[model samples]
Target: MNAALPFRDLSPDAPRVRVTLDGAPLDLPDGANLAAALLAAGVGSFRATPVSGAPRGPFCMMGACFDCLIEVDGVTRQACMMQVGAGLTLSRPMGKVAE
Candidate 1:
Protein backbone atom coordinates (compact mmCIF):
# COMPACT_ATOMS: atom_id res chain seq x y z
CA MET A 1 0.00 0.00 0.00
CA ASN A 2 1.18 3.51 -0.73
CA ALA A 3 1.86 5.46 2.45
CA ALA A 4 0.69 8.69 0.86
CA LEU A 5 -2.76 7.37 0.03
CA PRO A 6 -5.49 7.78 2.65
CA PHE A 7 -7.06 4.47 1.65
CA ARG A 8 -5.64 0.98 2.21
CA ASP A 9 -6.34 -2.35 0.63
CA LEU A 10 -7.94 -4.87 2.99
CA SER A 11 -6.83 -7.80 0.85
CA PRO A 12 -3.17 -7.13 0.37
CA ASP A 13 -2.46 -10.61 -0.88
CA ALA A 14 -5.09 -10.60 -3.56
CA PRO A 15 -3.85 -11.27 -7.08
CA ARG A 16 -3.20 -8.13 -9.13
CA VAL A 17 -4.28 -7.46 -12.67
CA ARG A 18 -3.14 -4.66 -14.97
CA VAL A 19 -5.53 -1.88 -15.91
CA THR A 20 -5.23 1.62 -17.31
CA LEU A 21 -6.50 4.83 -15.76
CA ASP A 22 -6.42 7.81 -18.06
CA GLY A 23 -3.93 5.82 -20.16
CA ALA A 24 -1.63 5.18 -17.21
CA PRO A 25 -1.02 1.52 -16.42
CA LEU A 26 -1.76 0.27 -12.93
CA ASP A 27 -1.67 -3.14 -11.31
CA LEU A 28 -4.62 -3.48 -8.96
CA PRO A 29 -6.29 -6.27 -7.04
CA ASP A 30 -8.32 -8.48 -9.31
CA GLY A 31 -12.10 -8.31 -8.84
CA ALA A 32 -11.83 -5.54 -6.27
CA ASN A 33 -14.14 -2.56 -6.36
CA LEU A 34 -12.79 -0.17 -8.97
CA ALA A 35 -13.24 2.96 -6.86
CA ALA A 36 -11.62 1.42 -3.80
CA ALA A 37 -8.69 0.09 -5.78
CA LEU A 38 -8.08 3.45 -7.38
CA LEU A 39 -8.28 5.21 -4.05
CA ALA A 40 -5.88 2.76 -2.50
CA ALA A 41 -3.56 3.35 -5.41
CA GLY A 42 -3.53 7.11 -4.65
CA VAL A 43 -6.14 8.33 -7.11
CA GLY A 44 -7.87 11.03 -5.09
CA SER A 45 -10.09 12.43 -7.78
CA PHE A 46 -12.21 10.36 -10.14
CA ARG A 47 -13.75 13.13 -12.19
CA ALA A 48 -14.61 16.82 -12.40
CA THR A 49 -18.04 18.40 -12.13
CA PRO A 50 -19.23 19.26 -15.63
CA VAL A 51 -20.09 22.88 -14.99
CA SER A 52 -17.94 23.95 -12.08
CA GLY A 53 -15.06 21.62 -12.92
CA ALA A 54 -14.69 20.78 -9.28
CA PRO A 55 -12.92 17.53 -8.43
CA ARG A 56 -14.98 14.56 -7.40
CA GLY A 57 -14.24 11.17 -5.95
CA PRO A 58 -16.15 8.26 -4.49
CA PHE A 59 -18.60 9.59 -1.95
CA CYS A 60 -21.45 7.23 -1.13
CA MET A 61 -19.54 4.16 -2.42
CA MET A 62 -22.90 2.88 -3.59
CA GLY A 63 -24.73 3.36 -6.89
CA ALA A 64 -26.88 6.13 -5.47
CA CYS A 65 -24.17 8.79 -5.72
CA PHE A 66 -22.93 9.80 -9.13
CA ASP A 67 -19.67 11.22 -7.82
CA CYS A 68 -17.68 8.19 -8.86
CA LEU A 69 -18.59 8.43 -12.52
CA ILE A 70 -15.87 7.37 -14.96
CA GLU A 71 -15.42 6.19 -18.48
CA VAL A 72 -14.78 2.48 -18.85
CA ASP A 73 -13.82 1.34 -22.34
CA GLY A 74 -15.51 4.45 -23.69
CA VAL A 75 -18.74 3.95 -21.74
CA THR A 76 -19.61 6.17 -18.78
CA ARG A 77 -20.26 4.25 -15.57
CA GLN A 78 -20.06 4.53 -11.84
CA ALA A 79 -16.66 3.39 -10.65
CA CYS A 80 -17.98 2.18 -7.32
CA MET A 81 -20.23 -0.25 -9.13
CA MET A 82 -17.42 -1.74 -11.22
CA GLN A 83 -14.84 -4.41 -10.52
CA VAL A 84 -11.14 -4.22 -11.28
CA GLY A 85 -10.54 -6.22 -14.44
CA ALA A 86 -7.42 -6.79 -16.49
CA GLY A 87 -6.91 -4.47 -19.42
CA LEU A 88 -9.74 -2.16 -18.51
CA THR A 89 -9.25 1.35 -19.82
CA LEU A 90 -10.69 3.97 -17.50
CA SER A 91 -10.88 7.76 -17.70
CA ARG A 92 -12.93 10.68 -16.49
CA PRO A 93 -16.10 11.14 -18.49
CA MET A 94 -16.07 14.19 -20.74
CA GLY A 95 -18.75 16.78 -21.44
CA LYS A 96 -21.23 15.34 -19.01
CA VAL A 97 -23.97 17.52 -17.52
CA ALA A 98 -25.79 17.04 -14.25
CA GLU A 99 -29.56 16.52 -14.49
Candidate 2:
Protein backbone atom coordinates (compact mmCIF):
# COMPACT_ATOMS: atom_id res chain seq x y z
CA MET A 1 0.00 0.00 0.00
CA ASN A 2 1.26 3.42 -0.85
CA ALA A 3 1.94 5.64 2.15
CA ALA A 4 0.38 8.64 0.45
CA LEU A 5 -2.81 6.84 -0.49
CA PRO A 6 -5.80 7.75 1.67
CA PHE A 7 -6.14 4.23 2.94
CA ARG A 8 -8.31 3.43 5.91
CA ASP A 9 -8.57 0.10 7.61
CA LEU A 10 -12.04 -1.34 7.53
CA SER A 11 -13.34 -4.03 9.81
CA PRO A 12 -14.18 -7.36 8.25
CA ASP A 13 -17.85 -6.72 8.83
CA ALA A 14 -18.05 -3.06 7.99
CA PRO A 15 -21.55 -1.96 7.13
CA ARG A 16 -22.18 -1.29 3.48
CA VAL A 17 -24.63 0.75 1.49
CA ARG A 18 -25.92 0.46 -2.04
CA VAL A 19 -25.35 3.25 -4.52
CA THR A 20 -25.87 3.54 -8.24
CA LEU A 21 -23.35 4.66 -10.82
CA ASP A 22 -24.34 5.15 -14.42
CA GLY A 23 -27.43 3.13 -13.59
CA ALA A 24 -25.34 0.26 -12.24
CA PRO A 25 -25.68 -0.69 -8.60
CA LEU A 26 -22.61 -0.67 -6.38
CA ASP A 27 -22.14 -1.73 -2.80
CA LEU A 28 -19.80 0.38 -0.71
CA PRO A 29 -19.07 0.56 2.94
CA ASP A 30 -20.82 3.31 4.85
CA GLY A 31 -18.70 6.43 5.39
CA ALA A 32 -16.25 5.37 2.68
CA ASN A 33 -14.78 8.04 0.49
CA LEU A 34 -16.84 8.07 -2.69
CA ALA A 35 -13.92 8.48 -5.04
CA ALA A 36 -11.84 5.80 -3.37
CA ALA A 37 -14.80 3.45 -3.29
CA LEU A 38 -15.42 3.92 -7.00
CA LEU A 39 -11.77 3.37 -7.83
CA ALA A 40 -11.61 0.29 -5.68
CA ALA A 41 -14.67 -0.90 -7.56
CA GLY A 42 -12.72 -0.66 -10.85
CA VAL A 43 -13.97 2.72 -12.06
CA GLY A 44 -10.96 4.03 -13.94
CA SER A 45 -12.23 7.44 -14.89
CA PHE A 46 -14.41 10.07 -13.31
CA ARG A 47 -14.60 12.88 -15.83
CA ALA A 48 -12.75 14.34 -18.77
CA THR A 49 -11.03 17.66 -19.05
CA PRO A 50 -13.45 20.15 -20.62
CA VAL A 51 -10.81 21.41 -23.07
CA SER A 52 -8.41 18.63 -24.03
CA GLY A 53 -11.00 15.98 -23.22
CA ALA A 54 -8.55 14.06 -21.12
CA PRO A 55 -9.90 11.47 -18.74
CA ARG A 56 -9.39 12.33 -15.10
CA GLY A 57 -9.88 10.67 -11.77
CA PRO A 58 -8.88 11.68 -8.27
CA PHE A 59 -5.66 13.64 -8.14
CA CYS A 60 -6.05 14.59 -4.50
CA MET A 61 -8.32 12.77 -2.11
CA MET A 62 -9.04 16.07 -0.42
CA GLY A 63 -11.32 18.76 -1.84
CA ALA A 64 -8.43 20.80 -3.19
CA CYS A 65 -8.64 19.37 -6.71
CA PHE A 66 -11.62 19.17 -9.02
CA ASP A 67 -10.50 16.14 -11.01
CA CYS A 68 -12.95 13.79 -9.38
CA LEU A 69 -16.09 15.54 -10.53
CA ILE A 70 -19.26 13.51 -11.07
CA GLU A 71 -22.99 13.83 -10.91
CA VAL A 72 -24.57 13.08 -7.60
CA ASP A 73 -28.27 13.50 -6.94
CA GLY A 74 -28.69 15.53 -10.10
CA VAL A 75 -25.80 17.88 -9.33
CA THR A 76 -22.11 17.88 -10.19
CA ARG A 77 -19.90 17.27 -7.16
CA GLN A 78 -16.41 16.29 -6.13
CA ALA A 79 -16.47 12.59 -5.35
CA CYS A 80 -13.41 12.69 -3.13
CA MET A 81 -15.20 14.88 -0.62
CA MET A 82 -18.36 12.87 -0.47
CA GLN A 83 -19.05 9.82 1.62
CA VAL A 84 -20.77 6.73 0.21
CA GLY A 85 -24.42 6.81 1.11
CA ALA A 86 -27.30 4.44 0.57
CA GLY A 87 -29.50 5.19 -2.44
CA LEU A 88 -27.10 7.78 -3.80
CA THR A 89 -27.04 8.00 -7.57
CA LEU A 90 -23.83 8.99 -9.34
CA SER A 91 -23.03 9.36 -13.02
CA ARG A 92 -20.01 10.34 -14.98
CA PRO A 93 -20.09 13.80 -16.46
CA MET A 94 -21.53 13.70 -19.97
CA GLY A 95 -18.71 14.09 -22.47
CA LYS A 96 -15.83 12.17 -23.98
CA VAL A 97 -15.00 9.13 -21.89
CA ALA A 98 -11.63 7.49 -21.99
CA GLU A 99 -11.52 4.48 -24.28
Cα RMSD, each candidate: 3.2, 4.8
Give stretches of model 2 more than 4 Å off: 1-12, 96-99
Off by over 4 Å in 1: 1-3, 94-99
lDDT by residue (23-90, candidate 1, tens digit) is: 88989999999999999988888888888778888999999988999889999999999999999998
Candidate 2, 19-44: lDDT as tens digits? 99889887887988898877766676
Give candidate 1's error at residue 98 in angstroms: 15
State each model's CA lDDT, in order: 0.88, 0.81
Count of clashes in candidate 1: 0
Best candidate, lDDT-wise?
Answer: 1
Q: Candidate 2 versus the native: TM-score?
A: 0.79
